[model samples]
Target: MLPCRNRTGKMRLGASIESRPAEVETRKTFGHWEIDTVIGKKKGKNAVVLTLVERNTDFYITRKIPAKAASAVNSEIKQLFSDFGKKPEKIFMTLTADRGLEFASLAELENESTKIYFAHPYSSYEREINERHNRILRRFIPKGTDINKISEEELERIEDLINGLPRKRLGYKTPEELFNEQLDLIYRL
Candidate 1:
């Protein structure tokens, strides 16, 4: 866990991304993920998008939330895990995220197998895959666009476009291809 100073000048505790195993960095494992939020220009009541990307397969999961509040983010994530059914741990072994207030309650996501890690302050590179995905999303949603105006179908289309794109890192295979391959392996195991 890393030591961080809260608004009241008190130290808050959270696990650091550095503590993650080396296998996560090598992208040899399928369950490790990186998470982040994409917010609309109007901060107060505008909606936000919660994004999670698989480290190895580059699979993307993006959800639109009402706001960036910890409760909203946590609830959505919990529902996501629930949708994964009885063995969410097999699909989400670890999550690395930024130290944003919206993710303050991330510890609640932990289970017997799943763990959460926070990147160092001001260090977005720690969650590079998430950051890159967010950038691509911005091309469709763009900065300052009201997320509230976007529909779920529109978001899915954007996600599909991204997943369908080939990546040199994946030897020119699309993210959808690799993600499905990993899912097949997980099911078999």
Candidate 2:
């Protein structure tokens, strides 16, 4: 992928296939997060859903936002974390996002503890967790359907189903299991 050229000639930082390749080595960090947006419907009329997955625990969070505009995405992210109760150190330690303008203001997400990184555009393999999570989400909310119509209660149910699925990646453990384990570990400390 080329440097994201917004309407202006300025080079925007987004996932560029050439820049971010597959992981050279997988690290065992717990708080590293993979972030991406799922766009539904046609170009003109669409709802964007932001999805995040924790690399170590396979925990996930999904939030439906108004559009893919950077401002909305950023605001939704803030809201999601706030809804989860922001203890920045315990929540997100680092974030990896694709080359979408929606993530351009990643610095705002950074606390002294949380770092933000970017994946090369079109490099789906880099954010593999988000990629697979999106596929699972598609089972309930197919592509080309307006996410706006989906109520929060329904979305929570979808999230519950996704979290409750037995994941081969986790040795047949459900994401909820791994997520709770990690949370328990943190509390025990």
Say which candidate scores most in TM-score: 1
User: On residues 36-105, what C-alpha lDDT tens digit does candidate 2 reach at each position?
Assistant: 8888786675577888988877777888888887788778777766764546477677778887787888
166 in model 2: Cα distance from truth in Å?
Answer: 1.6
C-alpha positional error of residue 147 in candidate 1 after TM-score superposition, expressed in Å: 0.4
Alpha-carbon RMSD, each predicted model: 3.8, 4.3
Candidate 2, residue 35: how far the Cα is off, in Å: 0.7
Which ranges in model 1 have alpha carbons more than 4 Å from their true place? Answer: 1-13
Clashing pairs in 2: 14-99, 15-99, 15-120, 15-121, 16-120, 16-121
Candidate 2, 146: how far from true, in Å? 0.9
Worst 10 residues of 1 by lDDT: 5-14
**Position 97, candidate 2: lDDT:** 84
lDDT for each residue of candidate 1 in 1-189, tens digit (9 for 90 to 100) = 988756796334368887888899999888999999998786669889999999898888889999998899889989998887777788899998888899889888787799888899899988999999999999998899999999999999999999999999989999899988877777777
Every candidate's lDDT: 0.88, 0.76
